[model samples]
Structure formats: C-alpha cells, structure tokens
Target: MPSVHIRYDNLKPAVKQVLFGRLRLESTRWASFKSWYQFSAFYCAPGEAGAHEKGGVEHEGGRFRRKHLVPPPQVDSLAELNERLAAIDVAEDARHIHGRPTSIGFDFEAERDRLRPLPDDDYDCGIDLTPTVARNSRITVRQGYYSVPAKFIGQKVRVKLRANELWVFDGRQVVARHPRLTRRYTYHDFLDHYLEILLVKPGAFAGASALAQARAEGGFTKVHEAFWAAAKQKAGDREGTRMLIEVLLLHRQLPAEALVKAMETCLRIGSVSTDLVAIEARKAMEGTDDDDAELLTGDGPADDAGGESAGQEAAGARVISLHARRLPPDPRTTLPDMSKYDRLLNLGTARETSQNQKGQGA
Candidate 1:
C-alpha cells in the first residue's frame, strides 16, 4: 500500500497528468483522473528503461510465469483459471525464500502488520461511456450489442463496462445490466425487453434475437413450444402467437421456473387458453393446489343439483338490490321572483325618459 513504481509506457491519462504536472502530455490531452489521484502515490520509471531499473518486478514476473503458467493450464472459464492461480499462490506462500530464515507467508504476515490499512472505499475501476440506444432497443459497446428496455430506444444512456459485467444507466438510475460479452458482433438480449413490441407484432416474436437466445439458454422450455403449437391449432397463427406472447408476458409477474412448471401442467392437461395458463401460473407461484386456486379465483364449477340446493339452504344468504335515492324538497328556501327586478328596470327607464323630455322643453 506504499508508493507503486510502474513503467512509463502505457500510462493512464490521470497518472501522466499528475506526474508531469501539465494539461497536455506529448500531444495527448489529459482527461478526468480523480480516481488515480485519490489512492497511493505513483512513480513512473524512465521511458525505454532497462530491466535493471525495475529488476525485482521483472524477476518476479519471470518467476511467476515459469513457476505457475509454464504449462498453461486449460480451464473452462476465467473463474476456474483464477481459482487455479489462487491455489497455486497459496501453495507457493509456504516455500522459504533464498536468503530469508522463514517462509514467504511468515514474512508477508510480519510486513502486513507494519503496513498501512487499506482505504475504506473500493476504487471504481469500470470504464464509463455514453451510447445511444438504437431504434431496435439495443446499445453497442465495444462492438457487442446489449439490449435495454424498449422505452429507452433512441435515447442516450450511460454505460459502465466492468471486467465481467456491464451496467447501463439512464441518468442516475440503472435501467439494465448484463454479463459482458467478449465476442465481437455478439449480442446479449433479454426477452422481457422485447415483449411489449412483440405483443403488437406477434409474427416478429418467432424470429427475435431475444427469443433465440432464450431458446439456446433453455429458458424457453419444451412446455412453451407445446403450448404454442396447441394454441396455434386452436386459433390461427397470429392469434396463437399473441396467446404465446401473453404467456411470455407472465414472466414479468411470476417466477420463470414457476411459469414454466405451470405451462408444463397445462400442456399435460391439453389446456391452451391464456386464462387457464395465467390461473395455473399463479397457483404454481403461490405453491397452492389447483382446486384451492380455482375456488379462490371463482372459476370452480358449481356442485351437483342436490349439493347446490343443500349448500344454498345451509348458507341462507340473501341478495339485496340497490336503488338510487331521491332528495327531499326544502320548504325553508324559495325561488326568487323576477317581477321586482323588472319594476326596477322600468323605473330606471322612466327616469331616463323624463330627464330627456325636460331637456327638450328647456
């Protein structure tokens, strides 16, 4: 946590500005570098420096590569590779150094006690960029397209690109987030983002990238396909697709696994109605039985004739009809008469006429 010595080559703009004490370095303009300035002091080695200038660091790099990465371990993911490297580091910590009396682990423990504690706040290492959402509700970052909410189409948004994920912000509020895609020209889409638009154009939902990704990820289960086919058979293609869209929209309110399970149960029963699907999906989400749910939803069938009459007699409930109430007349208040106002108007006219006649006689 003391001062760090780094090579001058490939220096960040903030570090360069702080070291050189100038707004422009060589021909590059300095950008906001508040993050680098807040932490430990930085010392840059001379340009084109020899290995002897940073001998310890250079030697350590070679030792690490030879000791741990020589064979180049094969791993499925970056997480797995990091796990292997961490294990290697822990194992190496027990080995004694060339001149040291104790192991590297002991030395590190002794030095760590004397070193300064880390700062309270972790540094923000993400790169921030502003990208406008395309009309198709996607934003391109580093040649990889990511979907935002369709409502944000044609609007500029802030993107924070981290090592493993990307956070999207519309102003201060985060609107969308996705795992970072390393492949160029690849897209990460969420089916929920396209649901609103797909409802209006059901045909486009079949060929949508979001749906395709969902299928690839197994999020679109076999039950969904079965239900869609059944719906299409019952209704036409467009109406069936719309029905499917309604089912998909349930994902907004229900857990995905629950919705899929409900769809599976519906498929087993050969029920393809959207209403049935919604009822079953809600039951699944609430972890309730079908009969109980039917009763609660008021969709359960009535009992047999004798059972119904018996139940009605046992309940003894009466239905009351509601009628509009009429207001009573008030005897204390009466309408104003117009005759007094008319006499006042005639008196004013007679005064005006007498004044005009007297002026003519004079």
Candidate 2:
C-alpha cells in the first residue's frame, strides 16, 4: 500500500499542480533514480529553471541504471534481481558519485526542506495487472480467491490484476485477464481458485462448492475430505473452518511455522478470535522468552519497557514491591461506642446469670 502525506507549505507549485491539489510533497529536493532534483517552481523567480526544464529525470535515470544495474555477475531469479537492485541502491545512495559535491547520504541527512510526500492512497494507473496461473491453481488478492489453469496448479502464475481488472500471466506469457468483481463473496465460486485454497486447508474447504463439484465429476472429494478430517482430528478443534480461515489470513504476514502454531493454539482453545491467535503467534515468534512469560501471556506491566517480564516463568511474578510502614491507630477505638457495642460489653453479666442458674441447680 502506498501512502502520501501532502503539505502545501513545503510543496513546489509545479509538483502540486501535477498532484492537482490532492497531495503534498515532503521535501524541496527529493531523490529520484539515484539523483536529486530541486522543486524550484514553487519558490523560484519568473523565467527560472523548473524540475523538468532542468532535464532532471533524464540525468537521474542514466546515473541510477549505470551505477546499479551493471554489476559484475548477472542475477537470474526474480528474487535475486530485486535483492541485487536493493543492494545497488544502498551502495549508490551512500557514495558521492554525482558531481553534487556532497555524498547523497550526507546531503539527505543535512537537508530539512519540505515538499509533498508520497500519497498513502492507492494509485490507479488504469493498466491491467493480472497475474496468470494454471487452470487448477488458485491465487488470492485482498483476502479473496481467484482461479487459474489446472495444469499450473503447483507452479506460480502471476496475477496481473490491478484494483479494477484481473489478469493472469505464466511468466512473460499472458494467459487470461478479466474485470475484477466488486464483491468478495463471488470470488469463491471461481473453481480453480477454490481448488487452490483447498490445497492449503482441505479440512475447512472439503465441502466447499468447487470441491463438491470436483467430487461429483472426478470422484476425488472422498480422498480430500479424508485428509481434511484427519487434520481436524489432529487439531482437536470444532471450529476447524474458522481456524483455517484465520490461518490463511495470518499466512499473509506471518511465517508458516508461526501460523501453524497460531492455528494449533486456536484449535486447542476451540476459538478463532483474532486477538487470541495474534497473542499466540507473537509468543511463537519471539520463541518463548524464559524471562518474559508475562509478555507471552499479555499481562506484562504497563510500564515494562524492559522486556524483562516478557519471559518470566512464574505465573505471578511481582513487578513492583511495596515497603512496610506504620499506620495511625483507628479513631473508632478512642470514640464512645454505640448501643451495639454495649451488648458485647454485657456478655460477662449474661455469663454470670448462667453460672447462678447452674449453682442453684447444683
């Protein structure tokens, strides 16, 4: 998600005009393509050079690509490509190669001028970006499901879908694209997408519509259902479906092991409350701090900045200690007593009456 913060007082007029009064830039000079461009249109005198007029984009792009892209060994995987690109960016930004006299790093540190920042709102360029997958596989977007070809079930098919239109791609090859539906409930009807989701959580998705159809036509539902049933039994939770859904949601941001632990905790408790699962996942993530049990239990002191209590093993660890002090005597002891107090005071007379009766009997 891209977020933008706009402040007119810090923005240059040209950039502001481009943003159309919708956003603000954070700084007067900002880094683009590894070079700095000064936003001069806002504060410059008439007939002075502006951002585009100074050939800023052209100059910056050339230096950035040359410095970052052409490193010695070529990268192969997309993951490696992105990693290498980041490394190059860090290195170039740290040095002072661009005849700007000061290191780009130092200049950034020293400068405090403001322009509009990047907008936090999702930008819609109107280009279709559907990631394609095989007919058997499933892909997710915004917590919803979509389908692709079955042959590509295990393989990755890129969805080129944007916020509006959905597209799928098998590498550079475009397979299928469609306009995304406005609602989420309809997404599950996409057979291939449901099949893919079933692969991850067969128990919860066993009776799902797509799987039901596949079972009727292909006779595979029994096998899948058995697997899901076994998984549910192992988890020992009646709310397997809810737990599975929660696990899927968490898988987006957490590691597989952490999510698995979270699911286990949810199943054990027979509840899929997001709050409880999050607590367990954090505990699993931090790996059971022996000195910070309270942290894991979510009962650490409000001011426990030192994660010291985070792993405390004791159930009732004392975070704060109170000192012993003398207190004043009760004022009621010095005051005259009420009639109720007289009854207790007359207990001796009642006992003597009982004794006199016993002596007369004797």
Candidate 3:
C-alpha cells in the first residue's frame, strides 16, 4: 500500500478518523524491526495492482481470528492465550489449505530447514513513552495510572509499554515495572515504589492503595502482616510501620521466598528486628537451591537499560507458602482454654457448661 494511518499518540483518538490521519510515511519502527528479523518487504505498485496482495493477507488473518478467537477464549493471561494459539496452530497443521494436496505440516517440513533462527536478543515491540510522574508517584499510561518512585514526582520518566507490561526507566536503569493495566482508569502499583515516601508518612501506609493492592496480590503475606503487627505493638503504629517499611526495602537485596521464610523464623522467635530479618533471610537464601530461587524484581529494581523488560513474567508473583517446608505444629498439644469458642452455642462462656449440655439444646 502507498499509505498507512498512524494512530495519534499510539492511542485510539477521540475522533473516529482512521480513514484520514497523518499521511503514511515509511514506518521507522518497522524499518528497525526488519533489520533485526533480517526480512525483506516487497510492496506492489499503488491502486488496483497492490490491492489483491494487501487484502488477502488481512482477510486470511481475519478468518483465522474469527475461527480461533471468536467468543473469546477464557484465559487467565496472555501466556495462556498464546499456548492456546500454539495448540490451534498445531491442530491446523494437520489440515490442507485450499487447493493444496499436502497438509500444512507436510509443506512446513519440506521448507523448515531453510528458516533461519531468530536473533539472539529479543526485539522490543513496545512503544517508548515519557509520562510525567504525578504527585501520587504515578504516571498515567493509556488512561490507567501506575506508580513510579516518589523521587520522580513532577518529573518525566522514560517508559516503555508493551502488550502485557510497562517498564519505567530512570536514565539508563530500569527502576520499576508492572503488568499493563487492562481496565481503563485503573492503576497497578507496587508497595516498594512508595516505601520511600511512606517512611516520612508512615501513618498513610495503613490506608495506602499500594499496601492494599500488595495484600490483594499476596506480595504482603500473612508473614509480613504478623511482623508488622508485632512491630507496631513493640513500637507505636507509626514507628512499627516505619520499621516494616525498612524491612520491606530489604526485598531489593533478598529473594522474596527467602525473605518470607526469614520473616516467619523471626516471628516464631518473637523478634521484630529488621537486622535479624535480614540475617535470617540471608541464611534462608544460603539453604535455598540457586536454580529455584528467582528474585522477585517487580517489587524492586530491574536490570540495567541494556535489557528490554518483558511483561510476560511482568506481574508480581504471589508468595509461595512455606508451611510444607517445615513440620506442621503438633495437633495434640494442649492450649489455654478460650471461653469465646464455647459461646457459639450460648453456653455461658464455659467448657463445663458446654460439656453437660451436649444434646440438651440445639
């Protein structure tokens, strides 16, 4: 085709005017990608001559989408959707295309050896954006809000947004990343991104959106809760939460599973020292197998600028339960009597009252 319509701001425009927009120039993005993929493009002459070639490609793709993606497959994530598509492609390979005597698989097998391997490095298909960080430490991208570091507030941070993830850059470093928000006007945030500001405003943390989201997403687990409550009791709420925030910063240095196990150990010993938590987390890391221990980096800093952040693995991973890693508490152990447990039956808050009145009243 002679022209392409460029979507303004890489977003759906308010005016329904795709038929007329900025005139199609050569695509810088596609040109860059062609070099990486080592592919050539052959465009036909304008008007009727090129129309057949152009329409056929899109028509075939539409047919595939309508056949395989109609009614929308129920999937938890994009990765699952990709898996479904792969399976569908495999299933389709058994069938022959129109006028083809051999199956698609058979045709592919004949030419498979000629296909070159993909480039060693992944080609980033994301759009580079520079959104200003709001006072709430968030940047609005595609009608959704996402928190950055508080330090970036009132300043522009480099951002790269892909189909499933968004990565924020500070100069040459990846400071934060989050799953791309699907719902319009919704935000996905990390607690660590706000921990610096929360240190000065500890009281705000209890009601923070990040903290609530963390709990909902299981980044702040029951272990972290217990530690926070203990710290709050030992110190005041303000100080305790501050202490917890300090411990939270340790995620930058320790793997999430290891840190959680350490927190559990410290809680068991009735200690809330941040130092103890760090020491215990390190000990847990020492015992953990290197291959199994992947650092939960979405909560902290990502790699240097050289690496492109992919949203595929972009979500904050839930805390792995450590209950089975250690022995279960002995069930037959005696416990101090709790009168409230007996009060369910209106049994006068006493076990003796409950014991004698077993079947006397329902």
lDDT of 1 by residue, 26-116 (tens): 3222232233333332344445543355557757778999988989887644557778988988998999868889998988888886555
**How are the candidates ranked when ordered by TM-score, highest leading?**
3, 1, 2
Model 3 misplacement above 4 A: 1-25, 44-60, 74-80, 96-101, 288-362
TM-score of 3: 0.65
lDDT of 3 by residue, 268-314 (tens): 65678999989888878787532123333233334443123443335
TM-score of 2: 0.28
Deviating ranges (above 4 Å) for candidate 2:
1-60, 71-80, 98-100, 109-112, 120-122, 125-362
Report the error of model 1 at residue 57, Å: 2.4
Which candidate ranks first by TM-score, i.e. highest?
3
lDDT of each: 0.74, 0.51, 0.76
Residue-level lDDT of model 2, residues 2-83, one tens digit each, is 1222122223422433433334343322423112222322332213334444345457777777766556446433356667
Global lDDT for candidate 1?
A: 0.74
Q: CA lDDT of 182 in candidate 2?
A: 50
